[model samples]
Target: MHPPSVRSERLVSPTGRGYLQLESHPAGCFRGVELMRAQVPAPDAPPARRPTALVIGSSAGYGLASTITGLVRYGIDGVGIGWERAAGQRSASAGWYRTIAAATIARDLRSNFVFRNADAFADSTKSETLDLLEERFGGVDYLIYSVAAPRRTDPRTGITHQSVLKPLGEPHTTRNLEFADDGTALLRDVTVEPATEAEKAATVRVMGGEDWSRWVTALAGRGLLRDGFRTVALSYIGSPLTSAIYRAGTIGAAKEHLESTAVTLDALLAGFGGRALVSVNGAVISQALTAVPGIPLYVCLLRGVLGDRFPSPVEQSLQLWEQLTADRPDVDERGRIRLDRWELSAAVQATMAERWRSVTPATLTELADVPWFRTQFRALYGFDVPGVDYAVPVATDLPWPGSPAR
Candidate 1:
């Protein structure tokens, strides 16, 4: 019997093995991807063939931020896959507020962007992506996987992998965080859940290496990758205090699988001279990370550290773009990209670990926001609303940074 990973709908590509097209919601009467598709290249734009890229989970948090960075920093016209209404409340499927915010920002810059609402984890979504690549652009040079979800059933095996965030092998209690209606100060309470072996496996199955491999294999089969084409996925290594709930816990197993997949993918793509990387990114409040076992406390702690100097998902994404398409090499010794390298430095970790030893639920806010950590947390979800006119009723119908002409 096939493992639970491969048993899905066997996403097939009837269209050329490239991108996917989405059902345009015309009745909404909103201008979105259409406006962003036609802007001419700026005179001072970097010299090169127009690079094409695709970012899955491109609605909120790191996903959305990365899409904007790709457009504003690099000239890579790309497609964004996520479930966001053009305007509405922030849903787990798609945070329309962030979508609109990103769209508004993209418009101000006259970018080429397209948003496709799809469940990126599914075989159907893969097929749709293939269609989009074929019809929209000839192919893609880069693919970014930043999906965050709970469960996935292998279409082939019908085995469902359900994700969980709990302490491993211990009945640990964590403070449950609840934000007030005004999104001001957070309230905390003790919460308990013992992560079982099944939960660990489920987390790995849902967030681990298999689907990523599938994506690369499918794309390579269709000739979507360009010369020296690249792919990247994000990972994290938090302080030891949260390690039990993060890297060493259920999600850690998934990351272990994911990191290992990079090497496997390198071998698989050896013929194409393409490469895959696992970027060790800093912690940020994407919809996905918000619900993790120990993330809220960690986020609060890390936010207190970075202060204004920290990087937002948008900024981190721009840095990531520079690493991919630019001549820059900002990777660490391990050849993996490191966005939170400095902030998570040996000195910082040592300090934070020491601080965590004495930290309690009462002191979370006080200790979470060191100058370095503060900036990092603020950068997670674009919460530090800058000079942008938040008062003005903004709309998400802005230019996409890297979308192709329809």
Candidate 2:
């Protein structure tokens, strides 16, 4: 009899290969976790002082990559703040498992890793972060804000704000994709509805920079932010194919607010010789990208357009982290950091625009790489890592970060 093979949790099955056979159990997934670990670039020589970095939303995506890179590269002690769901009867979110792997790796590397599993927007969580930093790492010099959420509740007024990914004023039609129940990808044109004024405000509230400002302000007020601080908040500016729904949409307004708040933080941190920067990352297929409507199709087209030049979330984070820590980075005229150079380059954008304009439903299959897009989508959920032995059982209840060691 043959051994049981692990089944993919993907919505669709690949007609081919190049994707990790996802295991629901975390223990069976260590190979992929370690794969991410191996990619973090280490520095030639460690820093003179043991620096501390406080990364908000540090469980998965860019935040997770940033924290892991800092630990491996600069030998920085870190405090990661996240609001991830705990593992339930079956399995937890990928972020939860990634947190487990991150904590374990940090301990193995002998780096101080403090995990804060709470809502970053809440005042109580801020207080807790401040208290923990005071008790453990003393004060943090690098503050990385990478929180991306669908909704947020105002702690002061108890009002819940949710974000939408529609156009700003009028409806816009765009070519997009939808997956069949059996996982067959189909191309279609979607007319995204416009956002109302209230919806726009709500989007800003949920995904904007107000909360980021509060964090820096509170940290500075409490002396939690050390001198010579550098705080970064990650944002995106994609191709014109997604410009309407992504760049000029309601989320765009939120990102504008976020960039504006970076300026605010920059001015505020200047009092202590600190700086605040907003890094414009490329159009990555991160969790946030997956959440936005109409992005999947663009990604599939982009994959075809920028063959062999696309960078994954891990690659983007490693590049940004290295530039920020070690080398002089490229910045735009507004003093904002520019990490999307490759994405927004003249050649790439021109080709993307030409292909986007020429793309059609009948030609989409030939023009886009559907299988690769599916692989990336599955990889986001920790489903598609290479060289993992799926036959073994993986632990689900790893000690929750910030819990007492038993």
Q: Which stretches of candidate 1 lie over 4 Å from their true place?
A: 1-44, 85-94, 100-112, 175-191, 326-334, 360-366, 370-406
**C-alpha positional error of residue 114 in candidate 2 after TM-score superposition, expressed in Å:** 1.2
* lDDT winner: 2
How many pairs in model 1 have backbone atoms within 3 A of each other, for residues 3 or more apart or on separate chains, i.e. clashes? Answer: 48
lDDT of each: 0.62, 0.76
| Residue-by-residue lDDT tens digits, candidate 2, 132-166 | 88898778888889988989999999999988898
**Against the correct fold, how does model 1 do in TM-score?**
0.75
lDDT of 1 by residue, 1-406 (tens): 0111111122111121111112212111122222222232233667376667788777756666677666655666767787644322221112443454455555566555566666677788788888788787878888888877788888668888899877777776655444443334453555556678888889888999788888888888887877788888878877676776778778888998998998899777667777788888887765577667556666665556655655656567766776776544567666688888766788777766665565665675677653333322333322232332223332223222243312
The 10-residue segment of model 1 with minimum total lDDT is 12-21
Candidate 2 yields a Cα-based lDDT of: 0.76
Model 1: per-residue Cα lDDT at residue 196: 85
